[model samples]
Target: MITKEKILENISKIRVNKKITQKSIAEFLEIEQGSYSLLERGERDLTIDRLLQIAIFFKMDIVDIITYPNKGSYNKENEEDIKAILQIELKKDKKDQVMKLIFGDNSLEILNN
Candidate 1:
């Protein structure tokens, strides 16, 4: 189950890892930084459209944004760990897409397996 809280938390990790500020995301979303902060803090309910917009801004699939690890156990710096999580969580086609997005040319062998 993809809970809103998990989605927010995953995106927050991505944002922090990428060194992107709330103000940058706020500007991208055309909303106030305070509003973005509220959303990140889970005080505000985010719409699916807004979430998709954020995913687009990050050049990531919405599933990748929302598919969090079990009990929130994950290493933000480990791409292989994230890929394994995504592989477990995603269906075949979506997994293929995510693999391509993450590893580009190197995903071929993984996708075949």
Candidate 2:
């Protein structure tokens, strides 16, 4: 059931949710904005190499992109990996804020201890 179209939709959703422009993504992929538009619009084929490029741009695992918000591979191991990635990308104070957003108020308190 996980068609290429579905995968494209998931990638598009991530880009939009993150407020990333198609032009920016296009530049990152070294393609024209119009071509990137076609990809997001499902008018062009999303090749494996391009998908891997996009995943790198987003600092995400391909599995993370395919499963996305539901995060099908999000077991304890993945959780730790995700936290480590976030730690590198975020400042100490910002990490707590992000953890709070994702895990509720008490989560940060527990994490800090």
Candidate 3:
């Protein structure tokens, strides 16, 4: 039920956030760069095994890379969206600046040490 577009978007986001090139992911996945490109473009499908490796690479839950089959993918309500993000940011302890940017307060239980 996951959409190829969403998978591509998420992969792009993760790679860019890490400042990694397709070559890097290809290397990380131990695949040819061209194959990785095809995968990114949805010309190829990601197997569960490869997806598990990606999950470990990103240190994320498998469900993250796999887009939910639910319809209306994006959150329409601002409050619900913000709350969900705050919870994740808090749990991940991503960064003080990012947490502040999202929640406007750095007093979260998960502090940047």
Compose the digit string of candidate 1's lDDT tens values, residues 1-113: 66888789998998998899999999999999999999999998889999999999888777777774332234445755554332268888998888899889889987578
- By TM-score, is 1 or 2 better? 2
Q: Which tens-of-lDDT digit does each residue in 1-113 have in candidate 3?
A: 56767877787777787787999889999999999999888788877787788778877666765653332344445555464332343444556667678668644755645
Q: Provide the global lDDT of candidate 2 against the true structure.
A: 0.86
Q: What is the clash count for each candidate, in the order shown?
A: 0, 0, 0
- The lDDT for every candidate, in the order shown, is 0.83, 0.86, 0.72
Ranking by lDDT: 2, 1, 3
Q: Which should have the higher lDDT, number 1 or number 2?
A: 2
What is candidate 3's local distance difference test score?
A: 0.72
Candidate 1 segments exceeding 4 Å error: 68-113
Best of the candidates, TM-score: 2
The TM-score of predicted model 2 comes to 0.64
lDDT of 2 by residue, 39-89 (tens): 988899988899999999988888888888776655746565664343357
